[model samples]
Target: MTLRRRILILATAVVLLGAVGVFAVLRASSRAAEKDRAQDGGPRVTRGEVALAPGDGGRRIVFRNMAWGPHRDELATVAADVPEGPRTASGVNCLRFHSAAGTGICLRADRGGVAESHRAVVLDAHLEERSSHPLAGIPTRARVSPGGRLAAWTVFVGGDSYAGTNFSTRTSILDLRTGRLDASLEDFAIRKDGKEYRNADVNFWGVTFAADERTFYATLATDGKTHLVRGDVVERTVTTLRENLECPSLSPDGTRLVFKKRVPGLPAEAPWRLFALDLASMRETPLAEERSVDDQVVWSDDRTVVYSLPGDFGADLYALPADGGGVPKRLMPSALAPAFLD
Candidate 1:
């Protein structure tokens, strides 16, 4: 071959190698960004800001702003015309129970490098930070009382597998009116089968409060069984009422309990069926949503139930009739952990 041709061939090979190197670096960067979005619960460029619509009276829907990307640690409202609200502390993974009374609670997780830490931050109704408490594990759920006088949350501890397989949960409650904190239900006196029992494996999660503020309901799990327990905030006592309930949410009228019940013979990944229990009659009625829901159901009104279902892009909120015979309807796209503002 001619010397000039040989030189040109070598130069072409060098250019091709450089192009391949650049392409590989770009691909790796894209993957890293995706991982960060998943861990931070932030928004992507394609997912636009959550559109807001005026609600009844001054009420609005407040939820995590996935469109805010890395800055999406705090909650945002659909009421775009309202004054700017408070922002959450850095690394907030979830926000819950934003109330019209001007108060809410959020869960922040710091997963930087090899160390991980979690926190629960209290916010005023305007979205201003109030208090922050150090938490022990990854946050799974959060809630505020009917009048916004109380706040509660659940976290997963022990290890990642333990949380992933539903092996352990740590639930805490705070009285915003009094600034008192019940760090965990394990500290409360518990009664099982109408008798007091002391067991180390007891775990509690899914707290739902009544209008009275002092009376609440939660799920207590131990000895491979889960029970619905009514608790007294003032007395710090929990009495087991029934079994097979997880993540119970009270209806707006305080007359019914919407909760997840584990269905036997199902795969471990999706074992729960949503049901509404009449508080007065104690009759359990299965809702029309047949899919297994892992969320703590939210009551949109006296007769409508809302919950989140995982999707390809993000979790979406869906509503169904609480009366047990209606089809599920989508409420919000790319949203989870819904709170109705008053």
Candidate 2:
């Protein structure tokens, strides 16, 4: 071969080799980082506390699915925080809040990626908050401690509204210790609208406490902008943890968090696809995924995630494997979201 030709061929081979090397390095780096994140994050859950309810009437804005089974015919106030209206239920995913006190909160609004406005209503096991706070108009959802002393709500401040909820909303924590809905902006991170934030968003939906009551978990939404801000009951200093997701439901043991995942493409209706994230490392794992999923979910021990799935004409309740979904077991098969009472 001519010397010039040989030189050209050799140079071409070296360039190709360099490109391949760079691609290999990038791939390996991504994998290594993911592995480290998972390792440091630990397991998705240690244990979960789940209640059983049939999936029947959760299709509407209101629902009932603790035990009634096929009899889950009546729909009343589930918990504090669902908007007080005629109620609504779409053909897609619905969010239901199940309290530790056998209370369930249901409302029909798209919250996965959009902000919403709602007439905040607080419901005790007896549904008394409805009459008490007849004038309240801030938060749409909240969590009260097992002792019933602490409660938190998600509310709004500016703009018109989002998903039937107030746009430019803020999260506020209520000290039910005084037995009133005082205007205290305790748990909110900040407010952003579809216009200001463009694509970034943050939402607080539910709050839960540890067995000790020292530290608790709050569910939140920010896509890639925020984590449910954690407040130390003792320190009184709120801190932000994790990067995505919200509405953290602690395992009965209080060691793990079974929260909702708000990925990059989830619509407002299908916000949470049922995922788990470690509170320690903040690494995530998918307990469920990409299909029909209910945002109102809690753990029935460490191995099961009880949630509701909307069907053709109605909603059905089903439990997915906490470790990883195996063949899903349909509880009320026709229900929406279920909360175990026992």
Q: Best by TM-score, which number?
A: 1
Compose the digit string of candidate 2's lDDT tens values, residues 158-239: 5433333335545544444454443433432332331223234545445676766456666444553446656555554445
lDDT, candidate 1, 235-281, per-residue tens: 99999999989889998889999998988887777888899999899
In candidate 2, position 299 carries an lDDT of: 65
Could you give me the TM-score of model 1 versus the true structure?
A: 0.77
The alpha-carbon RMSD values of the candidates against the true structure, listed in the order shown, are 9.9, 23.5
lDDT of 1: 0.75
Query: Which pairs clash in the backbone of model 1?
Result: 86-126, 86-127, 86-128, 102-125
What is residue 256's positional error in candidate 1, in angstroms? 0.1
Question: Model 2: what TM-score?
Answer: 0.53
- Model 1 bad stretches (over 4 Å): 1-57, 67-74, 79-100, 111-114, 159-166
